[model samples]
Target chain A: MKIIKNLALGVSFIMSTQLVSAASTGTTLETVSPEADRIALQNFYKKRFPNTELQDYVNGIYAVDADSRTQWEDIEAFPPYEFDVEEGERLFNIAFANGKGYADCFENGGIGIRQNFPYWNKEEGTVKTLEQEINECRESNGEKALKWGKGPIAQISAYMAWTSRGKVFDISIPDGDKKALAAYLDGKKFFYSKRGQLNLSCANCHVQGSNIRIRADLASPALGHTSHFPVFRSKWGELGTLHRRYKGCHQDSRSNPLDMQSETFRNLEFFQTYMSNGLVVNGPGSRK
Target chain B: MRKLTTSMCVTGLVALLATSPASALTVEESIAEGKAVYMGKSRGNCISCHQINDPDANLPGNQGPPMFAMAQRFPDKRILRAQVWDATKNNPISIMPPLGKHWILSEEDIDAVVEYIYQF
Candidate 1:
């Protein structure tokens, strides 16, 4: 057993030397195989624990005791990827007693729904976000209403975010429609607008001051803020939709938080999502 | 001349009394105590936003600046102390609440936080 241990140590030393030489010479080392890597790791642990299994060695090296990352993954897969989609599909298909389903409300059976959402609605003369669409669907159907921030309707929005995960965000108010264009402009203004008791705008932390160390890590940009949604917040211990997050932000800003499906929130989403055009949606982000 | 000599004698006695063995708190001890106050539940709760030098602490918020880099930014202890006392006074738009004015921290606690931050 002593001889075997000595042989392993000698082999590991030779392997490390070769790795260093290869790295310096910009050449690959044939001796540095996966088996060698495993053996080297095994030797390292042998010094700590004389008789631990390979599985145990790997597990000890790469162990993450917390479920924060997993929870975020689950949140990103919510709605379409989880049971929430089935509920949304049910709501989408169920016809009201007045013989109307969401299909009757929208011209496209909600197809291309993701494209035009967070868009300035020329007919309504206001911006409409996905959350508002859900509420509107409920109200038009004469169904019992779900409170904007609280219930299954928000979950359905999460489902929409999941379904639209890979779809590029494309929201444009036509130039010819000046009224709608003005609404879009208002959204843009809001993005840069400084409010709250702090007198800080979203731009302060996310745009001009990004990468500034806040406690431990740098702040991220607001450019792609809307790309992640239906995110699982560890603080909340549950998956939350984009509007729910908006409510949290408002509270953080010390502003009167808007209703979950309010027009202001929808417009804000529209503006925020428009800024995130072309970015791949990585929903269900984890944050400290 | 006698009165002048008596005054000098009294001054010498006062100086001797003032020089009696005095023990002052070290900066490190003050910092450690301040860190405890910051992390304590009823006090600053600063761990919610600010990351400390301690490596074991997890999940520090990105809402505020990290305490580790503060020494590099503000070299003067007095300036740093004032900043911690009331950030909004420096930048009117700052979201950070004033620890001193708001009664979020006691004077000793603030001094300790200042000492800790200065060491960082």
Candidate 2:
């Protein structure tokens, strides 16, 4: 067993070396296969919480914390987000002044399609997130773009996620495209690299600090970090998109937060959502 | 002679640079500066990791061990400062950043933080 573990380590070291070289050369950096990363991440969570079922990870921190789960279940029974979900639905269907709607701008009229977002737009050579696309939809319709963080974006995204509930996140890295892979790599770097004056990475709290309590709340694991969107935060007292939460966390880390749906954030969403590929969408979630 | 030395020390541009960091900050003022660096929205904000014994703090985080009985933990304050300078020196995989190694905190800022940290 020890030998096998050593072998794995040796292999990872070799892959990392090659990846570094590949990165300098602008070639495909196959630093450990994405499949390997996915397995390792999933197994880490599974080993930590042996009692948790694989699929239940989609529930975020509630999947592991029994104390919080009880309260969350009770809250879930008559979710505080119900009104916001209803509001989102209302906003989503509203036609713009150009006599067009969000439906006119997406595949399958944008219903039940939240999971496929943060896609590598090969032609555009950039990662595109749901919020960015939604803004694009508004722009294409000759309407003004809504702010990507709190108010309208969250409401509309919550409504879309609700409609797409139970659909597994199907984010893709795409094949044979080096630039797309580089974007994913950049996103992965963003996730692991330490930043800000406090010098903490997303992994520090979400991964290393797993099940650790912060004041009154438990820090959620990163495995299904992106499963929930447009969370109804008690702190904010309003609906908030995933980027809003990211911005909040960056501020908490004393890092200067980028604009919502900014390149790095979109990349972060891409990489994190890829980690959450198998988890089902359970957005429009409420959190205290 | 001592009084003359003290006044002369305060007199000129040559001496000004020696005490350039806004004179000798009182203990209370140093602690305040340290806390500001530790609590600012876009700065060190150590409250995000370790809990500290500030009466006015929001009880922010509990990721690292709480900051209490620090003087007891490391009787020599330099050891404490070194630890903050690079926690990875002790533990290779430590999550705490090397504040000094990475230039995250200036020498004066670090001194202030160490003063505040050692007090509690």
Best by lDDT: 2
What does the lDDT read for residue A261 in candidate 1? Answer: 62
Give the chain B TM-score for each candidate: 0.71, 0.75
Over 4 Å off in model 1, which ranges? Answer: A1-81, A161-165, A176-182, A185-200, A208-220, A232-234, A254-256, A280-288, B1-33, B40-43, B48-51, B54-76, B88-112
Docking class of 1: incorrect
Expressed as tens digits, the lDDT of each residue in A105-180 for candidate 2 is 8889889988888798988999988888889999988889998888888888898899889998888777777788
Candidate 2 residue lDDT tens string, B1-120: 656654543443244334433427886888888888777645566776677888866857766677778877754455566777777565543566678888888877776787777777
Instruction: Give the lowest summed-lDDT range of ten residues in model 1 chain B.
Output: B16-25
On a 0 to 100 scale, what is the lDDT of residue A245 in model 2?
A: 90
* Winning model by DockQ: 2
